[model samples]
Target: MKLLHTSLAALALAGFAGAALAQDPTEIRIQWYSDGIEGEVMQDLLDRFEEENPDIDVVLDNVAYQVIQEQLPIQLASGRGPDIARVTNLKEQAQHWLDLRPYLSDEQVAYWEENFGNRFDWMREDGSDAIPGFLTQLTMVGGFANATLFEQAGVEMPGDGATWDEWVEAAAQVMESQGTAAAFAIDRSGHRISGPNASFGANYIAEDGSPAPIDDGTMEFVTKLVNWTNEGLQLPDVWVSAAGTTYRSGADDFINAQIPLLYSGSWQVANLSTTIGDAFDWVAIGSPCGPAGCSGLAGGAALVAIEYTEHPEEVARVMDWLASEKIVREFSERTLFLPAHAGIVEEGGLEFQSDDPNVPPALDRFVQASGETLPLADQLPAWRWANAYYGALVTRISQAMAGEITLDQARELMDQDIADVVANANQ
Candidate 1:
């Protein structure tokens, strides 16, 4: 009779514990980064999500972009990273993502397949159909013209179908007239250079999916780049003053109105609008064309569910809520981020909002240019080995630009470095 009473008392305690556990909300942590005010916009939406779903709590960890780029793979590899992460190298890290298909209801799964199925290539392994995540911004690399500088210098802005040669000439005239230190300022990033490389007809990836950064087409871009730097047309301080994959932004020069032509991207729209209010008429222009075609790079970061999340269901819940058309539409506009949704993009473009009136037209130029990018440019960003390929390019090209190595030597090293990475990945 004493043992039976003890067993009954234990059972009673267990029942109470289970009831208390049921009332506890699941907490899902997000590893987030923001190029602009997107973090604030997302926080507002996340608060709304929590209000509706009382059993879930969302925590956003806004870390440095460098942390996401360098340290995230280490954390994710140890299976100790955040439940969700917003990342730029989507295909490079697709293996660590949690496929949300099984967690979704059959109807919801069907809807996802219908809407975002195609993009899963960037979120999957090889040909696997994994709905790992969706892009938060459809970003591209191009140039922004400080029109006030052009007008002040009495230099005509290069129009559509103008080649880089034409733009270079116009920029020279502007610099001579305005007495600016640099005629053209490019962000010290290989990603920024890759657009112009593609425009010159360089196929960044081989047919068999190998890295091939240097080709006849890319040589054209590299030659011009070196010439422009030496001739003082392109700022040497940003690219030549640094070496070994260092990032030096020319955004400051553009923001300071010291640069007439700044090679940046659509991602700068919101941040520049907020920071450069009424400073000048900044306009995003189409990428200057080349012999092959007018090419531009389209890429962005995605919010992905990590494979090691303890709260998979709750993570899916948050992602589903965030990926909804209405919410996505709102996020895009409020943050000035380009949406990746097909239907929404086709609904006459995003209703982009901004305090600065020039932002909308600048955004339109970027959007239109993105639409005109060559097929190869669109495909390269989703390549599984893009980060490796780009990293090698950055290192080698920066070395060349810094005069630590000749262009020929840099090209040779780039090819070798990328090949080694591909071989290791294959192994």
Candidate 2:
């Protein structure tokens, strides 16, 4: 009888332990990076999600953008990383993304297909039909002009159809009148210049998927850029300050009023509004025209599920909640980011949450300019080899800008660099 009683007690204890274990929620970690207010906004939404779904715990791991760019790839390649990551290098690292379709319900899959399906190509391998992820925000590369500087300098801001040359000349006038350090500056990035290159009728994609050789159209703008830098019209510190394709931005120069104009992207809207705040007026000028057309490249960051996640179902649940139409709309409105969801975009009426008068019009201008993108420029966002081309361009062009090589040398070297990337990728 004593032995039987002890056995019963042991069984009860085991049952109790099992029940406690079952009560514990599954934990999933999301590695996140922020450029502005989005991080705070996301955490608020996550808090609500946790309240609604008691069986799952979501941990938001905030890290630097450089971590996402450099370190995350290494982790993913090794089949170890956060369950989910927000990344801008979408195409290059698409292989490591988890396909949520198998885990998600039918209705959920249909909803994602309807809303974010079009952009799946940009973040997935070619010939793939997997639902890897969705873009967090859509970005358009464009220009911003300090309206106050233009006005103070009594230099007329370039009109809607102004060419790049005309805009440069106008900016130079402002620089002279305002006694600014430089006329204008572009972010020292190959991606930053691709839009302008496209505006000059350059197409970097070959008939196949490989990168095309540097063409006359590319040289037309690159030559002008190099010459302008040499002539002291373009800000030297932006391109010349960096070497070997290191990313640098002239945003500070623009915000500090050291330059009358800046070429960047729509992502800077929030940062600009918060930093500049009534210091001076500014306006996004869209992309200035070239001989071919006015064009800007389209790209964005995506929230992707990593393939190696232990809790795929939980990760899918978190993704679905965040990607719902209501959540997407709210996120966009609060963060002042352009929505990538087709349904939300078509529904319209995104009242950007910004007190600054400059914010809305700037966003509106990027939306307008996004439609102006050339066919070739539009193709680049989804192209796997686009980064290779961009990297080569920045490296060689910076060398040329710094007088380490001639423009012809830069052109030749760019072609060779792209060829090497293609060869290595094939192997």
Candidate 3:
């Protein structure tokens, strides 16, 4: 009787332990950063995903953009980071991303290949066919003008085919007439300037797949920008106010009505619409032309699974749910972002969830301008050394803007910096 009782208790304990283990859900963490309202929308969608997949738990770590740009790399190198991340610096860090081909069903993989295949190269290693991620939105670099400021100043906004010089000259007239701080300002980013550089015929990629030396085309725009800042025609605070490669936006200046023109990107659409409501009229003016052509860089943020993740199957489930055609359409609609899903983009007719009259036209303008991107500008997004070039440009150009170096000196430094990056990578 004593032996029977002891055996029965042990069996009960084992049964209880098994039940507890079975009830424990697999938890996966997603490191996310937001430029607009997408974070909130993502959480909501994730909540639904969890309700459906009760065995999996999704933890969203909402972080600053700087963390993604700077810290995430360090974490990834140490084999310690979130299971998934939303990142804009895709190509440079492609090796750390998980290939979902083995885990996802063939039909599902086909869907991803079909819809997001165009940008797979942008996020994957060269000559490697890894399904690392999908772009969340397709961003186009462009310009926006405060139309109310133009109207009040009695200066007509520069129309299509207007040169950068012409736009600056027009904005200068507005600044003078309205007593605004400066004419215009571009975001303090090397990537931001690359489009304008390409418009002047600057090609960063060399024939041997190496970084090209700074050319006359890059200098043309850089010189104009430097001269404009010194002349007080361009808002100096954005580039000169920050040291190193810290990003600063002229969006606030435009939002506060302190500047007439803001040369940023299409990602600002949702942000601008939300913040500048009924205060003034603004319009997307596309990219201002240069000697080569009017051009804007094409880029976007991608949601990628980390190769170091333990819960890859769960991560894939989350990625698939988020990347679904229905979810993609919904996310784009709610966030007012340009869809990266080919089906969503091809099917068209996304009724963006905004009553603002400016929203639709601005988005449409970006869609049209995306077609105008220069060939060189279009290729930069996928180039491995593109970030190296971008970083060097920002660092040296900002120094030039701050009177710490001459334009020629900055160009020399940028070339050397890029050469060092390539050399170190090879070594």
The pairs that clash in candidate 2 are none
For residues 190-239, could you state the per-residue lDDT of candidate 2 as single tens digits?
Answer: 99999999999898988986788899999999999999999999999999
Model 3: what TM-score?
A: 0.95
- How well is each residue in 1-427 modelled by candidate 1, as lDDT tens digits? 9999999999999999989877878899999988889999999999999999988989999998999988999998887799999998788788899999989999878867766676778767888888898888888888888899999988889898889889888988999998888888888877787778888988877777777657988878987888788888988878878767777888888888777888888898898899889988878886888887766788888899999999889899999889888988999899888788877887866677776888888878888888778777878777877767677777877677667789899888888888898889789
Number of the predicted model whose TM-score against the real structure is largest: 2
Model 3 regions lying over 4 Å from their true place: 1-22
Residue 227 miss distance in model 2 (angstroms): 0.9
**Which of the two, 1 or 2, has more TM-score?**
2
- What are the RMSD figures for all models against the true structure? 3.8, 2.7, 2.8
Measured with C-alpha atoms, the lDDT of residue 9 in candidate 3 is 99
Misplaced by over 4 Å in model 1 are 1-22
Q: In model 3, where is the ten-residue run with the lowest total lDDT? A: 239-248
Candidate 2 local distance difference test against the native: 0.93
